[model samples]
Target: MPHPATVVPEIASHLKRLLDFVDPLPGDVCLDVARGRGPLPALLAPHVRSLTAVDAARDGRAFRTGPVRMPGDALTAAPAAPHARADETGHPTVRADATALPYPDGSFSLVTARFALHAPDDPHDVLRELLRVRRPGGRLIMADLVRGNLAATSRDRIERLRDPDHPGIPTIARLTEMVTAAGGAIRRLDVFTVERPAEPWLADAPDPDAADRVREELLDEVDGGPPTGAKPRIIGGELWFTQTWAHVLC
Candidate 1:
């Protein structure tokens, strides 16, 4: 498996793409829901007027470890504070649930959820909560894994095996329905594919047997067999698959 340090740049690149797509205003007060590990919060703090990053997980140690260093930026340590949870850049971190945000209505100019919607049990409810905290005419952006084909059930099953917290990957239509039901007027939607090696992907699997099963199934699928609906293939001696990423703005 690749070291955690090596993964930071890849994550930063992905966040940069999402940020570019959202294009928040300089004066916008942004909220990043499910902001695990403080990378998104750290990257976003320098761009917006203020940032509030929250996650259901209450591990403050992750935040105090310091933010991911951007390309060409020097690495720095996180601030030493107890009651004050702000990092070195002054972006405050909170521990909260996404289904019911604690903030008052119309509290933020921009709200974002990145690679997090799939874990929520009630995605529509979470979207509604995000909408509730956003000001009138404010923007809501979500980026998550999506399955385009109806036959991708096996892919979803494999994902749940890898991460039990992953409820399931949503279909593009379901995503649209949830956003609309939450009072968002679908402004822009973009879908793209990301290919990555399979071993690293399953490195964090909650169940080793399940991970083995997933690996066997994926390998079989890639050996000149049915598509498995996940676009799996072996490229340059590495097992790889394409994951669909959807960016929705409303």
Candidate 2:
């Protein structure tokens, strides 16, 4: 398995793309549902009047990135932490269920959920709640793991396990239904799918021991073994996939 750190570059890139799709307006009240690590909320803080980060697990340490911290409960009225950095102003944390937001109707200008649509329990009701809190003409943007793009077999296996904690991945068509049913207008919906590269990064081979793990865990399946004489020059890669982004007007 690649270290989480090794994947940061790719994850950060995707996050930027997700945010670009949302394109929040200045002074907008933004709600980040299931804002796990606060990356997206922190990005929105400076651009919007205020940003609220919410999650079910509610880990303050994990979400705290320079003044931005995870919340305890959505119902509790708590103050946000001091801005750890200048750009992190007005980003507060809240602990709450995405399915049932604590705010009043039309409380926010935009609502966002990243990689949490796969959470157990149909997100249709939760999405309705998201739309309920948004002001007129507000936006709702979502980015989540998609099924059956690359490595169809692996995707099938993961979906079949049918873990309750991780509901089966939703398709683009199903995602559209949730938004439309919640009364959100579909303004811009685009899909960008790309396969993860098999070739490990240059820094991946930090030491001999680490190199062995990289080869075994990541490269071993390329052709069922190590590359052959000319295969090293063939630019081999992995099968992990990513969904770029999509958005809707609330």
Candidate 3:
């Protein structure tokens, strides 16, 4: 069996394909809000001129590539680590919130929210902030799980059990209304079904002495068992994963 972290690279390969479909322009200055674990930023680093990876949690920010520890910017009130001001490409990462960006109006050519828009206290305020940093004719790309678009009842119920900080992932029609109403024009929208087949992980009881027992326990506490009706009958059976990607131009 392979280590969980060891499987990340291959998973990132698949994630890149999804990201490319949403934002394909090479050499574009991009902002990745809530870039947990840096998979998107790592794959995107080489493809673009520069990548600004931002997150509120310090633990969720950094990514290591070999001996070099590439840490991301932290968005706390009293900043601890100095922000990655700029790299060779002149694109630097900063610690900031989506609802109140730290840049001047129309500062970036491209702004992206991958699985991040679903956590703001106010999604509309976050949308307005995304538009604030984008230049005229620039683009904003958002990827999130669309509400009621789940392929499985279990998945829908699972999301409901998630943190209250999680954003209300509205349907496609609602997303369209929110974006255009906030001065962003909806250019394109894609729905990607993300299916995670049932595995032994779902059936077997967790190991009490496992290295990540605490972590596993936390996950379970937050969302106990499979989603209410989202599970399939057979173990290792096919399941559906659905996420929405919307491209908006400001």
Candidate 4:
């Protein structure tokens, strides 16, 4: 796909890392759980044979695709929600919660969830449910923010302010333990960092006032105040912070 607008600067690279880690098979049928208003399905469409997206949202936010471009586009994104395409080229969608997926046992060759685990209240249950639909020998891959270099409590405070539903991101050890407890064995775990500008990042906040509070909290941390654990800094006169992401391919 050709990307023209540089909407989300980190998107292209984020997709590249996910694609490499997923190593999608041309013949593999994929199931992406928690299709939260992200560009992932659009970006991964070219690599897989068939894909289905399942999200908890009934509003068309589930349909928003990513901006089209290669890595050089630097996180260019598709247009805003309710106006974007309903998914890449007719990939099907199922509206369902993660804890109780409607698929039969062993139904998919590849199951994935990205940047999604932190939103669920019962992440362990969610992981187990995802595994239930996987065919024997099928791979279950997950990518989510984990407890990283920042002070976790402060980081979570800023996160929750932006999206009240956000549960705290899990620590690396806790994340792996959840997967194992959910009947998945460790295959590979990759950890990396991604930098995001505070303004654009907070722009997605459901409430403007909450977004302001989040900004204030981050700013407070930067000005020698108690750390918010976001480790906020000024770059190009824009506030930026880094997040630790863990990709687990089980």
Tens digits of lDDT, candidate 4, 1-250: 1111335555668778888899989988787776453456666667777776665543544211112223332111322223223445333445677888878899889998876566534788888999999989999998778875434577777778777877776777788788889999879989987776666566667788998887777777778888777787777667777777878998
Clashes of each: 0, 6, 7, 7
Encode model 1's per-residue lDDT on 79-179: one tens digit a residue. Answer: 32233365454445466777878888999999987665665347788789989999998988877778785645877777776666667777888888878
What ranges in model 3 sit over 4 Å off? Answer: 1-10, 57-82, 85-93, 148-157, 197-250
Predicted candidate 3 versus true structure: per-residue lDDT over 112-199, tens digit per residue: 7765656534778888888888778777876665644433444334343332233345666777788888878777766544333222
Model 1 poorest ten-residue lDDT run: 60-69
TM-score of each: 0.80, 0.64, 0.63, 0.80
Query: Sort by lDDT, best first: what order?
Result: 4, 1, 2, 3
25-57, model 2: which lDDT tens digit per residue? Answer: 887878787634446766776677777677644
User: Local error of candidate 3 at 55, Å?
Assistant: 1.4
Alpha-carbon error at 168 in model 2, in Å?
1.3
lDDT of each: 0.67, 0.52, 0.50, 0.69
User: Which model, 2 or 4, shows the larger lDDT?
Assistant: 4
Model 4: residues with Cα > 4 Å off, grouped in runs:
1-6, 58-91, 149-151
RMSD (Å) of each candidate, 1 decimal: 5.1, 8.6, 8.4, 6.6
Better of 2 and 4 by TM-score: 4
